[model samples]
Target: MEELFKEYEDKIPAILLEELKSSIDKKTTKTQLKKMLEALYEEYLESMVEPGESVGIISAESIGEPSTQMTLNTFHFAGVAEMNVTMGLPRIIEILDARKNIKTPMMEVYLKEPYNKGKDIRKVAELIKETKMSDIIQEVSINILEATITVKLDRQKMKDLEVRDSSVKRAVEKQLKSGQVKIEGDEVLIKVKSKDDSLNDLYKLKEKMKSIYLKGVKGITQVLPVKRKDEFVIITAGSNLKDTFKLEFVDTERTTSNDIMEVYENLGIEAARAAIINEVYRVIESQGLNVDIRHIMLIADTMTASGSVKGITRYGVVSDKSSVLARASFETPIKHLINASLVGETDPLNSVIENVMLNQPIPVGTGLPGLITKVKK
Candidate 1:
């Protein structure tokens, strides 16, 4: 196997070779291995584009055609409404647009070792879901006469969550920087820290204190523990990739967020690229569309090739195009033209759009090759 691999290492792709080696057994003969290598190499060659092929347009059309048949509804419950995911055309558009704030930001948190086997499923789920001060509080009252806010904490809920009152006090004190928090029996008393504070400020503080981050992962509104195949997984409604990774039980390698920007920030551009491809493919697959994966990969490559995830819009990938005409053709022709003119830019007519604008042969396919002849001297 080693010798066979060495014989075709330069000819075949490393990824293809690796897959072939892993699938084949010791009983496989050398001749069979050589034949397999040749077949893969041939297929690879056939899969490659022709010189100066207009691949970008083809990929666009391929993706665009199937996208029209996609479902209009954005959310797909997949039998669990709590885990409702954005799907179909809206999701594809959301990803391709590279919108910073997606419709539904979610994360799939995989656990490590014992926890993954459903040892502490509910406990793990509770630990991930964001617990606001209001959620764990039984009642909140504002005293007009004394100008104090009284919060009665639900001891049962706190006990079930294994959250101590001291921890709650600390969390409240941390958030309510200008207020004095005191524990009176089972109720938490909040008094103005400054004598100059007004009733409006007190009301504002009361509203703000309700949202204080008391426990669990912040931004995670809901968490559902699911037994996927055998391993238990936690699906969240909100994405906080950075904080989620800090948890000791989380499997950072397998745990991933659906927000592409979040992935890019927490992980890197490569991971973001993979996320984009996976996310787009997932939407298409869910919609029962048959668009080619290569088209999706091509778009992903374009989006991440610049070392950042750029949208397909004018402000993103289009703005960075080398050809002024290509940029103009995408969107805001007047603006692009004005900017190019202001900069005294020149179009070399190397790409498709520029040549088409000049009414010349678009430099792709047969037009890519130019004639060079020597005349009689």
Candidate 2:
């Protein structure tokens, strides 16, 4: 312990040194400790990049090569035909593109103690799933002669969804701006009171009435309670992270959404950075391929370093480059050249791509070392 501090006092932090001492005492023998320390030193040395080493090329090659083996089609979930996750190369593109809206937005909501232990899980699922007036409507009929619209609600479906008939009537009346909302048995009838209101008005009312917000959390279309290991978790079809986090029984720390922008908006950039790494890692791992996590981490860091998520496309990271040649190399060379000419932009030839394009030695590795000659005496 004394020798470790003496040798690595300047190199390793005090907090990390203390942790190492505690870990060594609890988890390792003297022979294992020596090997572990050596391994740590070697890992530290291997983690660094040479001054001029091109990280962008390495990262692109590392991920792009393995992605070719990924499947082209979407993978279906068992027992649920509607839920299909975008996998393989397409998913990889989505993450790199940093699209505002993904092909499928989903959420995994974890519960608190009692709820997580399988108590009233189905009830919770019902509470989280969004239910609209149209979801329970048996039929909607528009009357051109009477200039009225009548909606028939399914009694059994309403009972199953725990939606009251009175609540449905209130929502329709509010939308239609009518006080005389006649509820006859399971049917709701509304007629145009003014002579100016035509058949088109009644048809518009029918369309608007069906989309009325009835009950449950908004934006969540479907909910499925799945069992993993020892606990039951709710998988939602739509992601409403802001509203979902407000639930009293939800475990906010463990609850996560697949929408990258949603995570960025609510949780900030650090969480957004983590989400990118996790998502890319998940896609690759799902395809039964093992990749070094550091490569994915590098990409995530670059995307979020500007304090917002940026795609690899011309509109994003490429546009943000300092060198004019680097941006031109990515896409639309003539456009970039014309824009640079208009702005009178100068290329410093500092980076790898720009220097390589001009057939000059890059300012990295051996190229970085310069020798000075003394004046002749």
Number of the predicted model whose TM-score against the real structure is largest: 1
lDDT of 1 by residue, 187-255 (tens): 999887665667788789889999998778989998888889989999999999999999999999999
Off by over 4 Å in 2: 2-43, 175-180, 369-377
- Minimum summed lDDT over a 10-residue window in model 2 is located at 22-31
lDDT of 1 at 49: 81
- What tens digits encode model 2's per-residue C-alpha lDDT throughout 333-361? 99999999999999888787888888988
**Model 1 error, position 43 (Å):** 5.9
Give me the runs in candidate 1 sitting further than 4 Å from their true place.
Answer: 1-5, 14-47, 76-81, 373-377
Candidate-wise lDDT, in order: 0.89, 0.85
Query: What is the number of backbone collisions in each predicted candidate, taken in the order shown?
Result: 0, 1
- Candidate 1 — which pairs collide? none
